[model samples]
Target: MSSGSIFRFSVMAAMLLAWPALADTHTPEEVPQTFAEGFIQGVGVPVISVYHLAAMIGIGILVGIAARGVVPVLAFGAAAMLGVAYQLSPYDLPADDAFVALTTMIIGLLILLRKPISPRVASGIFAVAGLVHGYSLGAVVANAGAVPVLAYVTGLLIVQTAIGVAACAITLGATKWPARRTVLLLAGGLVIVAGGLAAIEAAGLIG
Candidate 1:
């Protein structure tokens, strides 16, 4: 079947999943019970989450400053799938929170400096961040049915790719400006602060 067909079927499945819930008078918003709902939730959830938003901004900067191809972006998406798969499994990844904080901070540092790392290293950073973030994202749909999960993944990739590409484009364009370095430094500093706060919160040093 074509990808479009598969997506249509997925949506149909989600609607079927919703029928019983609807008949029972359950609140759809209480959980993702439709493909459209799941996809929207997936797209908006990451952007709305403060820590993830900051980290994503840092990621976009890293991508933009590198001025490389989409390999890093693709790597992130692929690795994110692995993370979500793991979350769907019976196991829990150890030290995930610490590792996420570290990655977030490192990406911020790189962006703050406005220095492009090697493509290989940059892709690795993207993968690590994607894995951790995806694992966390999976929690939202952990108990969801197959169709909603599929829709969520689809929307997650679409939105994230858009964000990464948009940021990279802007950064690339900004490179010609005289104060490009200063602008990059300011953005990176913000990411660093966001990452640091995430780390402190994870460590329970503060609420």
Candidate 2:
């Protein structure tokens, strides 16, 4: 065979072999599983699932664009808080953890309305939110045991960091008033609506 053909054949064989290994490394688990299992089963918990992850990443990019005047450190602090909130809180379809979800929405809206808060302030807010996020993971760990818990939390952290980085990049690139204002307005509206829904749920108005 020609060199090109041989190279193609080798590449195909490698991919074929790699496929099974990847599958073995990431098999799905049975139901009644912990939050982490659910997260890992979907391949990460950054925002509960792929759809949520995409939504949050989009939100982060918008927030970054709106907050362009801020430095990377500050922008990242805000983004990280949002990321943790999106990931750990049970805001998925079934909507578990209404309290955390409500709190996150309130905080997100506050950030959207107010000018870029100090990095110190953002950091403190994120620290408190992070504990709630961590506790959500701990709940999973307590119920599901170690391995699944680790996998779930690891996936969440990896996705959270990536989204935070993307948000910072968006903020760095924003330079126009119209785009920034639009993002802030839209994000603010979303937070308010989501917060309202969460509040209702927390008050026992929703299932």
Candidate 3:
């Protein structure tokens, strides 16, 4: 790899390692933060939030394998909107980061197995994953008010959809190249590693 690429990966690894080694307790609180800052943070979280990012990447890879990015993305978005509504309502669901970790691991394993599941089943799986992920995201912006929270969610949706679509495209491209299966399996392996670490972190056993 190029030096610049190595450096960037190193930075990302460092950031991921620095994610809280315990259950997430961050709640959105009103402050001097601006709308632009909120939007930026929303976009950045999928990249910087270690456990979440790990799960997202794993799920994205699985989506790529399934070659159905749109279903999961839309399902996730709808569930996320519902999650936000739950957050804004009287109902409460304690979102432990462990769920995210576990979900990611599941998705990674599925990719590794390379089993053929129906599209509807796959969508259902992704939707459940979305619920877990969305609830956590909703919690993060719980106190940011309706409009700002909506804006943040919008940013999240855009970034997340992009990531999913990109992963799918890359996987499709790899499948057309020589040693396609090998490349796909290798990608799956990487997702597993990332998910495994995130799982450990979520368990508070390591960071």
Which candidate has the top score in lDDT?
A: 1
Candidate 1: stretches off by over 4 Å: 1-30, 205-207
lDDT of 3 by residue, 1-207 (tens): 344434433443343344435324243343215677567656766665544565565555566666754576566656656665666677777544676667776776787787655568877887777777777776667667656676777778877777666555555445444444654465456555666666676677864
Q: Give the best candidate by TM-score.
A: 1
- What is the C-alpha lDDT profile of model 2 across 118-204, one tens digit per residue? 555655554554444444334433445445554655565556556655554544444333344555455455444544544565567
- Give the candidates in order of lDDT, highest first: 1, 3, 2
Better of 1 and 3 by TM-score: 1
In model 1, residue pairs whose N, Cα or C atoms come closer than 3 Å (at least 3 residues apart or on different chains), thus clashing, are none
How far residue 129's Cα lies from its native spot in candidate 2, in Å, is 1.4
Per-model RMSD to reference: 11.9, 12.7, 5.3
By TM-score, the candidates rank as 1, 3, 2
Error of 1 at 34 (Å): 1.6
- Error (Å) of candidate 2 at residue 179 is 2.7
Model 3 has a clash total of: 0
* Regions of candidate 2 where Cα sits further than 4 Å from its true position: 1-43, 49-99
